[model samples]
Target: MPTSPTTVLIVGSGPTGLTLAIELARRAVDVRIIDKTPGFPRSSRAKGPNPRSLEVLEDLGVVGEVLAASSAPLPMRKYRNGVPIADAAPFADARPTPDAPYDRPRMIAQWRLEEILRARLAEYGVRVELGSELVGLAEGRTSVTAALAGGGEIEARYVAGCDGGHSAVRKLLGVPFEGKTDETQMMVCGDVEAEGPDRGFWHQWFDEDGAVMLCPIPGTRSGWWFQAGPETDASGAPVPPSLDSFRRLFAKHTRLPGSGLSDATLLSTYRVNERLAERYRVGRVFLAGDAAHVHSIAGGLGMNTGIQDAYNLGWKLARVASGRADPALLDTYEEERLPIAADALDLSAERLRATMEAIRKPGGGLDSAVSERTNGLGGGYRRSSLATGGGTGRLRAGDRAPDAPCRDLATGTPRRLFEAFAGPHFTLLGFGPGTAQALREAAGAHDGELRAYGVDVGGPHGLADDGGHARTAYGIGPDEDLLVLVRPDNHVALIIPPGDLGAVGAYLNGAALERA
Candidate 1:
């Protein structure tokens, strides 16, 4: 029998699916999220979210909880043949800017992060329907029908597959996952309990034969993440990961007793796989996160990329589902994200090669792999069709709208551009007097779909740039008049003259986002 219909059916309850569910639920869009697993796993595969992902969490109203549950990235304690050699702090000099609050990624177990997202989703009256598995998908003229493993079907206006690398949805879509898997390069990883290493730093052991790395997991008394070169038997075949094998590997690399390591769980083998799906969508069904793409885990991009993917697709899905935008708006999902995924594959591959090389040398460790590029702040959609009109100074259409501190004119309270951009509505910022009329017109025209604010122009919706950070961040001169339209995802959709109301209208119309 078919169940009640939902606006969107999210397959998989990992970070990706949870994010999409939160996005939709917050917008009052009916959403159902399911996971094949009976319950949440205890695994902590991916370390944590990056800076960009943190921003997404902030908009979703759960960044404070995440901050409380996570730890700052620790320094790396390196060893050679089991003797401590060097200490490296990759993010020692990293600091947050006025516009970017997070300078580096936090260190938290993947399971903990997922728990936070799930809790946030619950606040919006949505819960992960565990034990429900998606076995098949059928797209109709207006909705998608998903077949569950247990003799049930769910109908939804859209379906997003955020399932992992071996995604059933991708297979059902018959989309080719085109990429190579380097079997030779592999790592055995697990959550473990160990007695010896200090928890202050991420400890790494290097030797002629292999290496073992262990980082203490946050929110756990003795939990640690263990990763190492695969253990092989006399036949040179990799030994299957287990408590015994994990203990043996730890003892062999760190020269610690096997008895010191215990309670090994979530054991798995990781091979270098770089795969991207041929298409992100087929009819009303779509793919996100690992279902859409998979990459090497070098740059810590796997989970963060998925979080960002959900963030990108969330608002667009909400608008289209609510009939506020044309169905064609959904096409931009693949157009913008596919290219970014390709670039991420290349970046992670390059980072992997470099880190592997660095680990081979004396007194070198994974800390050397950290850099600004891995911060995930530079990505933009400048080449995207959604990036319309001309740019001013350093910022242009499709770039992330940077945050700036200011004062709200009505209440004279301190506020930030991010605060204005927060929520499911598109934001329009008008700089100087010339933009005031356009701001008023745009607000009157779009109503609930858009929020218009005037910067440095005193009015009901005016914001005073006390520190001048807003103008500088947007690259506007002291006396200039500019109008910047930001998408629901915080990316600039257009930058035009203050009085060019036609440009704003054209962009809004062309984007097919007018409220019905």
Candidate 2:
């Protein structure tokens, strides 16, 4: 421990924990992340990051590595009675637009994604403390004291529980995890080296009894993800997942030779659990990711939801820890995320039922589970109290701020709106010429905390929108002179006229006690 207290103490080193650690570390917040595991596990629990998560990764400067290491979503080749019957590409029609650069999700191992995040965290001189498990927690009026498993204690200004669904922090706070676990719907999942399936398509074999899916793992020559309904014993107890058990299941379902599958690793039995924490925070301790909520894996929203949770809480924690914002601002975390979690649970449940029904039909695949809602672009904090001020055009307060192609006026270099929104500062976009004064005032008032860019204003910090993509993406008319204030997480916080510049200051003031 250092002479000064840690700013944030993050428990667990999964995607959620790693994400929060990076967020706080990039802001120069003294953050300490710990995981109970003795060493990092190469578990590919979640398939990959969704489109919205790609945006978050882009901000964290790791999307390039992820893209380089990942493969696009593959088409599913469905087989009936061990014979290939149908091939369906779920995201074949998906294409990137100026507003949304990533149209489809990539297929990368979860462990690999965590490795990338951990490497990025190291760049900030922060590393995950392995085998450091949190056993006890006591919150003071201003700080939290965490008890580690090995007879050591750490004091942090704030504590974030990024541990999985079985979060010790959430349990220590006595928060009720209210949900049901569907034991009847259990699947054995693992990573294996298989010889039968080609790496071109996600192969699925269906029969009257059940189905087994094998998806080729990106960045691996012979690796495949094995998933299927759990095998049962005579007494109806699920046989624990093992390499031999996985081979038996594969042979039973796919009619492939048992010797074709070997080197099975990261085996686990997954029971469909849909649970949400009763509360996200108690005093200075907060829960995020699976610590706050867990959902069905049908829509692949479980990990993405957790990542977004860390994204939402990271800046608020940093601000409050630095005294840049009032402690009350932290309450908005639960207010906005709880509803989103509830919605995700319902959506996943619905998708699970629909997918199960679709699987019963011949040549039916998981393609029935794909929809616009699963893309991760439509989620926003529209009802959040932070979303104030009236909307302009088709865009509204609390909507995700869309990106567009633009150019840096000063250097004549090409740039995108995402580049402007990157980093740990608020972004204020002035749509037209009338917003020049507003942009100047905002920049002058909040120098380091905010970045104000004028689109077509022909002034300092003006962006040259030669293609008019900026205006079209933001839904602003050619002559429209509205200002859109974006939060650190890239959500539109406010949309107001240039003359109502006072509202911007008022909103910021109301959210925090004072500007540091």
Candidate 3:
């Protein structure tokens, strides 16, 4: 039987799926999310959100709660022969700046992050339909019909497969998940209680025989993430991950007593894999997160990249699915995100190799590979179809729109550019008082779809860049008249020249987002 149609049918209820659901739900789009499992996964698989993902969370209004429930990345404490050898903080150099608020990656479990996103979606009167697995997909030019494993089928204007690397949707679509998996390198991981290692640092024990790492899981005093190589029996067969196996690995590598381990759960074996889908979009159906790409967990990017994939695709989907923009707007999702996924795959592979090499030494835990690149702040969509403008300024169209502390000229209260850019509307910021007339005119013209703010040196309305923080962060000068049109996803969509009202109208009208 055919169910009622939805604007978007999102398969898989992981971080990417949850984030996409919230993004569409908050926009009032008819989005439905589903998962194959009957219950939520309790495994604290992915460690945390990276800096860029945190920025996205802030926009989605969940960053505060996430930070409240999370902790900072722990410093790695390397030990040799049960003796502390060295200590290093890989994220020490990451500091918040005016342009970027989330400088450091925040450590929260992936399952918890998904729960938070689900709550946010619930705020919009939406909930994930768990156990409603997609068993088949029939893609058409304008819509898709997804067959569920249960009984019925759901038809939607568009379908997004936010499912993981082993995505059934991808397989049915015949999308080649192209990459290599290193069978030689396998990691046995589990959630266990360890009383021996201090929770302040991520403890790593190394000996000529092997190595084992135990990192404290935030929000729990007794829980720690244990990872080690596979243990072989007398027959040289790999031992399965169990409480006994984890205890044995810890006792063999570290001087910690076997009694230190208890309540071992969420145990699984991991193989080093690097894979990316041949494409992100196929007709009206699309892929995001692990469905599009999967890589090593070295840089802790598996979840972060997936969250960003949803972030980039969310607004585009919302707009297109709502008829706010042309269907061509949907194409940019792959154009902008595919390259980043490829880059992240390579970076994760590189980081994994670097850490592996570093592990062969005495004072090597997280070495040069753990740099600012892993924070995921520098990525931008300069070459995307939705982005334009170049030549000058500190930033360009397609760059991540910067946030700045400013003053609201109306009430004389402090405000943030990010606060203004928090919703699902285009943000137009006009620099200096000279552009007030044009900004006010544009705001009146495009009242709801595009919000216009006057960032002035001394204007009576809109935002004021006190001490020039806004100007510096936006890379605008006091004299140079500029207008930046930031997309709902916080990417600069178009950089209009001074008083280019025609360009604004033309772009908005062409994109079919010209409301009010």
Report lDDT per candidate: 0.89, 0.89, 0.85
lDDT of 3 by residue, 1-516 (tens): 578889899999998999988888888999889899999998799989988888899989999999999999888899898789999887787678887888788887777887888899999999989889889999777778999986789999889998898998899899999889998889899899877678999998877778898999888988998999889899988898999988888888887787899999899999988999998988988999999999988888888898999988888888777776777877788889999999999898889898888888898875445767898888998877666554245788788888899899889899999999998888888887677777877788888789888887344448888879888877777787777888888988777665676667667655422221
**How does candidate 1 fare on TM-score?**
0.97
- Candidate 1 residue pairs in backbone clash: none
lDDT of 2 at 265: 91
* TM-score to native of every candidate shown: 0.97, 0.97, 0.96
Ranked by lDDT from best down, the candidates are 1, 2, 3
RMSDs, each prediction? 1.9, 2.0, 2.4
Where's the lowest-lDDT run of ten residues in candidate 2? 507-516
Candidate 2 deviant stretches above 4 angstroms: 1-4, 511-516
lDDT of 3 at 151: 76
lDDT of residue 240 for candidate 3: 89
